[model samples]
Target: MVVENHVPLQRLNTFGIAARAMRLARVRSDADVLALVRHPDWRWQDTFILGGGSNIVLTGDVRALVLKVEIPGRRLVHEDARGWLVEAGAGERWHDFVAWTLQQGWPGLENLALIPGTVGAAPVQNIGAYGVELQDRFHSLDAIDLETGAPLTLRHEHCAFGYRDSVFKHERPHAGGMGLKGRALITRVRFWLPKRWRVELGYHDLQRKVAETGITEPSPQQVFDWVCQIRRAKLPDPAVLGNAGSFFKNPTVTPEQCADIIGRDPHVVHYPMPDGSVKLAAGWLIDACGWKGKTVGRAGVYEKQALVLVNLGGPTNPCTGGEVMTLARLIQTSVYERFGIRLEPEPVVVG
Candidate 1:
């Protein structure tokens, strides 16, 4: 129930951006949040919920009250012949949770290994990798409304999950008009891991691992290990070089659009979706635009992967959020000019 002032945010965010939260509170449980909501002096103030800080960009000092979620726990909620329902606190690290599930004989989350951030942040971004999205294994979640401190439970349908999207990402409601955004604070999340586990090697990286290893029937642990290896080889560790995993979502286009791009550059990397749409590789586009290994104002495109944008200056003298966004906008402008499609940023911007 302690509220602190002038909290340093450099260590909190994976990007290592130098910023300060005017006021910050660490909420380890639902009760802690309720206690804060009932506090006389801070009851009506605007609050920002922070998870692992993996999916955000800090442009400047955060003026609002920051609730740094630190809740913790993991348990099997229910089990049946079909699947096992597991619950984890919002603050649990996502990659560790995935590994823990595998050790406990739950094979469903292995493909999502090595992803940075907290469990609560996963649903916000609908985090996905290697063809498995959080929505695929999600059961339900419990959250506390910041305004009233009232507990709320939402099922999978209530989340309104989409490609790297959820109700949590939208500040304003869409057609259904039920956006949660910054209004609710997730405390716990439950996942449905099926007993009849089938390995997901749909992504090109996983397929390459299988081919390279010559292991046709890879176990869950093997898949998890492979994912970590691939990510390590391709992505720069945040601890060494500050970065937020992928900078942009893979843009989807119609068949005609794909054909048009192919006509212009036949080597363009793209994938055909089940829904008849084409998913164009954002990295390939950025690399094709000659941004890879290039730096703009201390913000640079990763040499190994163009999708990732990194802070060239590191923690000592990190790039400003303004520099990162400037580079992002420049890349977006170039891609749009070349492909006639806009690339949207994946991280949430905080100021």
Candidate 2:
């Protein structure tokens, strides 16, 4: 239990937003995490569990105890007729784990390649890319309760996962039924990946690349490399300029709303939502509003990828969330003005 005070959080998060934590503690193992959880200072009051910090915006100095989950280790628990069961620590870097699984010849995560954050956070957002999502490989997880010092095993169904949402993100963001809101910390995640391969050529960019390159027999590794390359070319490196992956989530619209928007703007990019609703590309919408390259203070939308919001340069702090929200507001206002659609944010805000 290494506890440091007033530490800068820029490097911890992929966004590289300069946020400060009053107390930052790194838990190297489950015991370490439990010891800190038992600490009276944080047991009864507010605290925060942070992984890679890729999917959040810090507004200001976080006053609560910040637990940087460093618990590590991974194992391919089983391989059978069905698939490979990969269990990873909550603190493992998601990309690293994805590559590791690929190296072992297991597939399924290649489509979600290069996504920043921890293995734990993947389930919270049901992290998706191209035509794949976390739910496709999800099995179960062990979450520690912040209140009663109990551990809860949440199966796939128990998480109540949806698009960019889960129990921990939605109902738990404020507080949930058992008074366990953000209180449940995912300590480990079990993923079920296929032993065979799945090459999703559904994303237009990938298909375009496949066509241009004439790659008919794309393996999982090839697909992963391509996705990583495309992502690297578009998304700014958090190691350089600060930014969360995507500020706003693609908004889901009703059939009528989608029809209206599509009719009004012929170029609007929309994917059919699982519920028969339509998921409009927030990036396309924002870019259409002429905000792709727009800036607000040091924060602005990524020039090439409209979904990404980057920090031009600013004071070290967390309110990066607010800055992004500003752009999101503009996007929402403009889209509503143009097509009557509302854009929503995907990151967790710890205001």
Candidate 3:
């Protein structure tokens, strides 16, 4: 258990925002988590649960205990002819775990190769890329209720996953929902892998990459490599620079709205949604407004990836992290003005 106060979160989050936490605690085991939750001093205030801080924006000082979920363990919990099942400690670094699985010849997690953040945060977003999502292979999870400190098991239905959201993120806490406010904190994630893989080519980019290779059957590693290569070219590394992977979730709208946008701008990309809706590429809207690589001062859009917002150096807004908010508002306004569609931010912002 590591405890501290007035911890500067700039170095912690990928956004590099200079925010402060009144109290911060790191837990490496379920016991530590329970202890922290039961701690008399911590039980009375609003708290922020942190993992890798990849998808969070700290706009101001957090006057609460910033509990970082660090419980660490990984093992093969089960295996069968259909697939080998693996369980991961929520606190484990996600990308490293994916690499470990790849090394072990696991087939389920290959397409999620280089995504940043902790394993715990994966289910909050039902993280997807290329043609696969974490939920597609998820068996279930173990989460501790923050209030009662009791361990609860949750299956896929309980997760309420949607595009870039789950009950943990989009919905309110156990208000008959899966949000992690008072009664939820993920501790373990279970996966079901395959003995023989089915190569998912649902996404066009993945299909095009495979088409170029002139192969129908590709090894999991080959598919993984291709996805990684594309991500490398398209996404900026948040380590060298400061950025959350994607700044916004691609907005979903009615087909009629999409058709109207397409009529005006022929290049607008649209992915048909299941229930007669369409998901638009936010990158297209941002690029359409010529916002890519555009910056005000300290905050800027990533040069390579239009979806990413990077902090250049010094303080941006000099006020309310307004510069960062400005970048967000610009993308929102421009997209709305151009296509009448609003791009929603992906990161959780603490104001």
lDDT of 3: 0.81
The TM-score between candidate 1 and the true structure equals 0.98
Residue by residue across 5-44, what tens digits does model 1's lDDT show? 9999999999999999999999998889999989998889
Highest lDDT: give the candidate number: 1
Candidate 2 lDDT over 104-126, as tens digits, reads: 88888898999989998888788
Q: Which stretches of candidate 2 lie over 4 Å from their true place?
A: 171-180, 314-322
The models' CA-based lDDT, in order, is: 0.93, 0.81, 0.81
How far out, in Å, is residue 114 in model 1?
0.6
Question: In model 1, where do residues sit more than 4 Å from their true spots?
Answer: 175-177
The candidate with the higher lDDT, 1 or 2, is 1
Each candidate's number of clashing pairs is 0, 6, 0
Clashing pairs in 1: none
Question: For each candidate, what TM-score against the reference?
Answer: 0.98, 0.93, 0.93
lDDT of 3 by residue, 1-351 (tens): 557988888767877788888888886788887887778876665767898999987778988678888878888887777778898999999988887887887877888989989999999878888767888888899988777788989888888777887878743654366466434778889888888888877777788887898977888888888888888888877776778888888888888888888898888877886689988888878988899999866788888878888878734433235678888997899878877777889888875
- RMSD (CA, Å), candidate 2 to true, equals 2.4
Question: Which window of ten consecutive residues has the lowest lDDT sum in model 3?
Answer: 314-323
Model 1: how far residue 46 lies from native, Å? 1.0
For candidate 3, give the lDDT of residue 210: 73
